[model samples]
Target chain A: MGAIKKFMYINRTAPYGSIYSLEGLEVALIGAAFDQDVSMAFVDDGVFQLKKGQDTSKSGMKNFSLAYSALGDYDITKLYVEKESLQARGLTVEDLMPLTYEDQDDDYQEKPSIRVVDSEQLADIIAEQDVLLNY
Target chain B: MLHTVNKSPFQKNSFDTSLRLSRKGSDILLIEDAVYAALKDSAIAKTVKQAVTTHSIYVLEPDLMARGLQPARLIKGIQIVGYEGFVELAVKNDKVQSWL
Candidate 1:
């Protein structure tokens, strides 16, 4: 077989504070469209993308929680959230996307099936990728 | 691995680590506040030299412009890249890690 092209997606922003998370999602979507073996990881503020019940309406930003749910349809599974981020915010993985598979549609798996990764695991996983994109 | 340094070379640990790890398989990308290192005579610029001697490094043009500076005269061998180039880095490197 030829070289396996693995792409890692790094998100480093809060959901409502800036365009970083939304843009990250768009870039990941585009990457999956091109058929890359992709993995998503969140660090620092990036963990906000996986938080549950985000109401950006008060801030006048479009809620993108649904977009995250759709990542499975594109086979963009294996999402990881930094454990430190959740701890810093006094939250646990349970407060984030609660399910990994969604029954909403058969075309994709459920949302919130993300794995919680500590910094060391994150570094190890990152070292294994062939391609890495950040948002 | 390609390391993305978006913070000031002094502020975040990424810059220093990226440089130390700048072997044949790794690169350092200056993004966000990290682009501050691209300025002439800045603290970070001075430190970047050590990394350049061993590895490839670059700065994001948009970030530099956002800070109202040009990389034309500041860097000796550092390259400039657009957002698309950032994407290209992801496509080419074995791994991409962001130091935020």
Candidate 2:
């Protein structure tokens, strides 16, 4: 009956190395289902999450990168990355997506896209959120 | 005048959230595992340093020693608060948020 609420999901872990990344994604997906406007901020090693070509298959893992694309369909469009993190890792928005594992075989597939910003914006974005869940 | 908890945010979301939104003068102490910010001299330390100058920020001395971190490595304005000093910090801050 009130207005739709805004939710912020702060992810601070990398995938594979720990269970935090996958679990955080599950939480974000659940939040999206409720139609609560959702956004995600990837910090520290968490930036590894949106990498362009993830090969979890060889590591005996399901390719979670596919799940990222599904976020757009759920209206969870605001995926933020720290510019400092990006530079620290020698990464750029262009490096994040534009290729996929399928492309390794010369197939056509669109990978996930990462929007980059600096720490200043990261703090501001956190402050702007009505409900912030950090995991 | 300030308090700080160096624990990872997600590991202690409730405590970290409280620290972030606490009164302007309140401080959130950082040290040990929380000292990950100081490792690479990253934004976390930068933000904490700025906050400490205007507010209060404390670091756990024991934890830093365990990790082989020296006081000289710590950013300016940040103080090394011992265990007893830590308890005193909790008593001083209006509310205490433990991120562990």
Candidate 3:
């Protein structure tokens, strides 16, 4: 295994506006294959990447929001969503997709990995990462 | 701080804004099209040279090559790094701010 470093992926762009959100998800998935400790922080318009029931058929672009729900299967369970970002967009956790993972340990109980944090707490999380990749 | 800029200076003002806002002695890594700013004799190169007086600048080698820019074409005082060096910079810096 490679050196296990703390990696925090910062998502600050909105979904479908630019390619940042999808590209960020691609990198996070790639990082998971490396066996590093990976976490994601949703700030600014990045919180929109997690909104549920996104219909992109009209735009002819593939809707990739469902990929966020599958992240836990890769053992990437740390997803920090900034509270202020969501509130500024007039969204709540209820507007996000229901994401839960079946933990292999502890009898495979399902648990939610999405964490709602304030800006201050998110700052702390950013400070704690060994590597921060912005997308 | 290690600042990574991936946008072109001509298309976006992020490279200029990053130079304006970064603290003195901060390192800026020009990746993707931002490497164009480091090209010798370019208009933005002069401003980038001025930035080198206070900030240590680096460019992603692969990106430069991908864009068909030769290392010799880059202005003095700017270094080139590969992917491993990119990770090293992230580790060496206290914080990283991306110019998006």
Candidate 4:
């Protein structure tokens, strides 16, 4: 009904420490219904949300990290992760879950959606957004 | 762009990460608990002092006062602004990024 607006959800909190990380993901999933241009940026401790093998069994909390792999179905494929954030936390791209989306424009070929960017590059990406939602 | 950090730098990496990622000449506004980073003698003062060269740094006046901090105690090059200034910063910038 309206022009597609760029919506970027910046996640800066760690998972399980508080509810921000999960809430951010939930809102992003819900926002997908509107079909606007959506992207998520994981910065600071937010990178923890994508870490592989998250076990919450002892904490009794649900392991929602798996839900990220489903984002491709929602058509929310862009997930920019800050490289410095990962290094500061002693993590690498390999430590994250392999999230991919089938590129409809490219004959439905599966393609990686996570882009690990340096701070300078991430700043440029952030400046181009029409709306920024922080969590 | 304008970047706002609301968490304390001493307690969180929000301030450092924001400072590192914000583009050159971008406006960085310290508000809420983040105003503490503007103090001249704080552990982060050196970093704030260095950031001023590349970015315009501002602290919420009310938040600073509420924390018992005086303007004279703030690091040089750091300006103090009120709520109106906060709104103005948001309006002036093409976008606002909050480091929570």
Which portions of model 1 miss their true places by more than 4 Å?
A1-3, A99-112, B1-100
| Chain A TM-score vs. truth, each candidate | 0.85, 0.83, 0.94, 0.97
Task: State model 1's lDDT.
Answer: 0.70
Candidate 3, residues B1-100, lDDT tens digits: the string is: 8999987665579999998999898999998657767767554666888998989999987666544456776789999998899999999998999998
lDDT of 4 by residue, A89-134 (tens): 4467887889999999999999998999999999999999999999
Pitting candidate 1 against candidate 3, the one with the higher TM-score is 3
Q: TM-score of each model's B chain?
A: 0.84, 0.70, 0.96, 0.96
Which structure among the candidates has the greatest TM-score?
A: 4
Tell me the DockQ of each model, to 2 decimals.
0.02, 0.03, 0.02, 0.02
Candidate No. with top lDDT: 4
Measured on C-alpha atoms, candidate 2 has an lDDT of: 0.64
Between candidates 1 and 2, the DockQ winner: 2
Per-residue CA lDDT of candidate 2, range B1-100, in tens? 4445555433345334545677776676775356434433543555555565665666776665543345665677767777788788778766656555
Q: Considering summed lDDT, which 10 consecutive residues are worst modelled in model 1 chain A?
A: A52-61
Candidate 3, B44: how far from true, in Å? 36
TM-score of chain B as predicted in candidate 3? 0.96
Q: Rank the candidates by lDDT, best first.
A: 4, 3, 1, 2
**Tens-digit lDDT track for model 3 on A1-135?**
767899999998766646888999999998899888899998866776787766554335577887888898888888999998766544678867788878888688988888999989988888989999999
lDDT of 4 by residue, B1-100 (tens): 9999987675589999998998889999998667767866544677888999999999987666444456776788998888789899999998999999
The C-alpha RMSD of each candidate to the native structure, in angstroms, is: 15.1, 11.8, 16.0, 14.9
TM-score of chain A of 4: 0.97
